[model samples]
Target chain A: MANVFHQRLDELDELLVDMARRVGEAIEHASAALLAIDTEAAAAIVAADEDLNALQFRVDDRIVELMTRYEPVATDLRFILAAVRISVDLERMGDLAKHVAKSVLLRAPAPAIPDSLREDFAGMGQAAVRISEKLVRVLAERDQMEATQLGLDDDVLDALQQRVHDQIPDLGYGPQVAVDAALLARFFERFGDHAVRISHQVVYLVTGDVHLDRS
Target chain B: MANVFHQRLDELDELLVDMARRVGEAIEHASAALLAIDTEAAAAIVAADEDLNALQFRVDDRIVELMTRYEPVATDLRFILAAVRISVDLERMGDLAKHVAKSVLLRAPAPAIPDSLREDFAGMGQAAVRISEKLVRVLAERDQMEATQLGLDDDVLDALQQRVHDQIPDLGYGPQVAVDAALLARFFERFGDHAVRISHQVVYLVTGDVHLDRS
Candidate 1:
């Protein structure tokens, strides 16, 4: 029974890693769609969000089933709870990616961000993707080292977001473009945030360190 | 043992209700700060968020303890899980409130939002407080009626957010104010979103329905 419980925990980790990978893809694709103003790709990212949502439901169901069948206690119970929280973060990251996609769709045929700001956004997108990739490793390996790196990566995303905000006024874009650019930067910043949150959960699970930053 | 377990569950509910009430106050205070351009009130809201974070930690400790002691199964198990999820939403609502307050602080002595957008923000603030009041009742009583009403309440918030967005471009505010206004509106919208999420968890606990809207 103990071995089986461990195996189930491993299975749960695999599911979380899978969700993180898809979130990374969604972020990458959404960024591409935004940069290229590819409405079709944006639509695909939006559509794929449903799959991530379904996956989160699956994770939740499996968690309940595990608790019902095994009645895991102490560390195992905490680990399961962390999995539930991690899935929420992963699902939210997917939604953030979808929000990015929707922004592209909102300005179809016309680029959502002005060219002056594209380089900063491209940097933000790359930072988001990098953070997500590290998040997948953190989930899969429970590596505290990788988990800590997510915070630094998120800091980079935050800086990029700030840069974008600073540049918006000088670009002389209209309100619609400015609003979209602000919101898009925010979406990427928030995507990195969820990744950091999931990594914090992993760190808590691995090190029993509960100093979570709920910012 | 079962009686004690049920009592512990009640204690958990009380903690959650307490958290909800504080979150409600945070939103009310933050909104007031935003409308008044009261930096002092904004600072208070920011400081108070730490209290909410501490409260969430308390709730989380209680939850882990309950699971450890009871190993609750089936419906009880699901209820506990829902509690975990609901606390997360409440904590996030507090964060959104803090974000509103921070926005006010960012432009201290000068309003973060222009005078023209004040009416819409006022409306958004009122709607947020109303939704939070309903959320407190939903958490305390598990009243599916109040829980369901949250959706409609959030609809009001979404509309208010939309109105704010529509007005932003026309306000002729520079990029900084425009960015701030856009983020402030998004913050309020997200607060409503979190409230709705908590209500959904309450409804699920009451009715065993799981058609959650993660949008």
Candidate 2:
């Protein structure tokens, strides 16, 4: 029975990493659609978010099942709980990606981003993609250092988000353009927040300690 | 042992509702602050959010402790899990309220919502307060029917949010005003989202079935 529980934990971990990869791909596509102005890719990302949601439900169902079967104790309990938290963060990240894609679709032929603001969004998109990719690594390797480093990247995204907000009055775009720029900036900032939360969850999983500052 | 477990569950439920009440108060203040441009009220809401966060941590710690001590199964297990989910949703709701307050703080003396947008936001804030108040009742009373009705309020909020987005171009506001209006619209939409999620979670707790549409 104990061996079965351990095996299931391993399987769940694998499933989590798989979910991360899919979510990362979604973010990557969102970034691409943002720059390329490809509604097709954006539409695809929007449709594909369901798969991630389905995946989360599966993860959640399994977590409940594992608890009922094994009644995980001590570190095992914490590990399972962390899986629940990480899965939620990943699922939210997926939704954020969908928001990015939907932003692209909303503007359609006009292109959501203005020419002058494109570089800032490109940088924000790049940082978002990088964070998503690294999230997979953090979950798979359980690398404490990697988890810690995620915060640094989050700062980069934050700065870019601030730049977007600061430049809004000065972006000198039309009303629709300004609105899209502001919303896009917020979406990227929120995406970065989820990444930071994932790292916090990972750190808790590894350290098994309630965080001080985060509290 | 059964009596002790039941007693603890009752205490946890009380704490959960208290948290809800606190969160609801936060939303009310945020709504008032948004329209009044009262930085003092807005700043107060921001500071008070940490207290809500602290309350959540306490709720979480207690849930874990209850689970560990009682080793709950079946309904008892589900109850504790629901507590965890509800606490998180409420914490997030509190944060959303803070964002509204922050929006007010961002503009300082300048009102966040223009005169034309004020009526729309007033309506949104009223509905939000109603939802938060109802959330308290739903949790405390275990009123599943009332929980289901929360969805109707969410729909109203969604429409208001749509109106905000639609009105941006025609509002004739400056670039900064447009940006704030768009983002504020989004914040209200997300606040409505958290309310619907709470309803879903309550339904799940009552029915013990996975939701069909959300996935």
Candidate 3:
């Protein structure tokens, strides 16, 4: 029989996959809301985030419980520690998606991106979705090569964020519109950051070193 | 033997307190630099933040060492866990301070805050400093009352952040200026979040319950 501790970790793995699925759907809705300014989709994304947070709490509790009960050292302990950090990162990514949704809600009935900059936002939102999808795969497979690809993907998102700022002057919106673009750009950029962090953690789990930042 | 484990924790506490101090100073300089557009102060703030990050690394290493070597359970273990989370929060607060400073550098020799929003930035920056000071006290003193005040202080920051939005239309800046204000206001607000998280961890350390969010 699988030990209770290993069973708990397996349970956590299932929950993490579920959490990632929810986050993917949340960001997709958030992106759609950005394009169409659908307040209902925005609101639904916001409401759906609580489920992610609940999963985070459950994951955290089980990790701490396992640590206390089993006191697993070395590899097992490191795995648990990685779980704690990954859960935090996943929760944070959920919040970032909600931030995008909140941006939509804040400007209800009006699209957050100007028509001229719509492509920029579209690219950003899609990059976020793609990065998270790859991140979930990396988490499950511990694919070091795919993990490296996440770093490369992060660079793409960063360039897109830089492009948003560079194009801001040409877009020529008022203060509120500018604020929305700046914040939305950042929310998208941070989604990539969380994905990269999860990739880093996965690389750590597979290899001994978590120092994948150099790529 | 002075129980090297507790000694390690004590060293971590001292390092964290020092890190908080450094972050407080970094934000203060960042704020002053914002108002004056003082490139030198902004540069100094950016340079100093690396120290905070280093201290965070030290604190984190020590916690894992303690956890692994001593195999502490219950209260001792909980303290180490909280320490790890608190360390992350403090390091992130440092990064927020650096973000503010970088905003200054990116717009160097020119204030990141527009003339119209100077007063708003001043209020936000000062509040960030005040919150960090209180946060350090809560961490050191484990003063629950002090910890609770951070939530109230955070409310003040939230209001200031909201006020920026309300004032945006009247302020009437170009896109770049509006982005600056929105991002800067957010940077200040997130500093409060780190403070509140630290306070919550401190409260959790003391009360054996991490439920300070509702309070």
The best candidate in terms of TM-score = 1
Worst 10 residues of 1 chain B by lDDT: B204-213
Model 2: what TM-score? 0.96
Largest DockQ belongs to which candidate?
1
Q: What share of the true interface contacts does each candidate keep?
A: 0.66, 0.41, 0.58
Q: Which has the better lDDT: candidate 1, or candidate 2?
A: 1
How many pairs collide in each candidate, listed in order? 0, 0, 0
> For all the predictions, what are the DockQ values?
0.73, 0.55, 0.53
In the range A25-68, model 2's lDDT, one tens digit per residue, is 99889988988999999999999999888888888778788888
Q: What Cα-based lDDT does every candidate model obtain?
A: 0.89, 0.82, 0.80
Candidate 1 local lDDT, A106-188, one digit each (tens): 98888988999889999999999999889988988888888778889899999999888888778787877888999999999
TM per prediction: 0.98, 0.96, 0.94
Off by over 4 Å in 3: A210-215, B212-215
Q: Which DockQ-derived CAPRI band holds candidate 2?
A: medium
Ranking by TM-score: 1, 2, 3
Q: Could you report the Cα RMSD, in angstroms, for every candidate shown? A: 1.1, 1.6, 2.2
By lDDT, is 1 or 3 better?
1
Q: Which 10 consecutive positions of candidate 2 chain B have the poorest summed lDDT?
A: B206-215
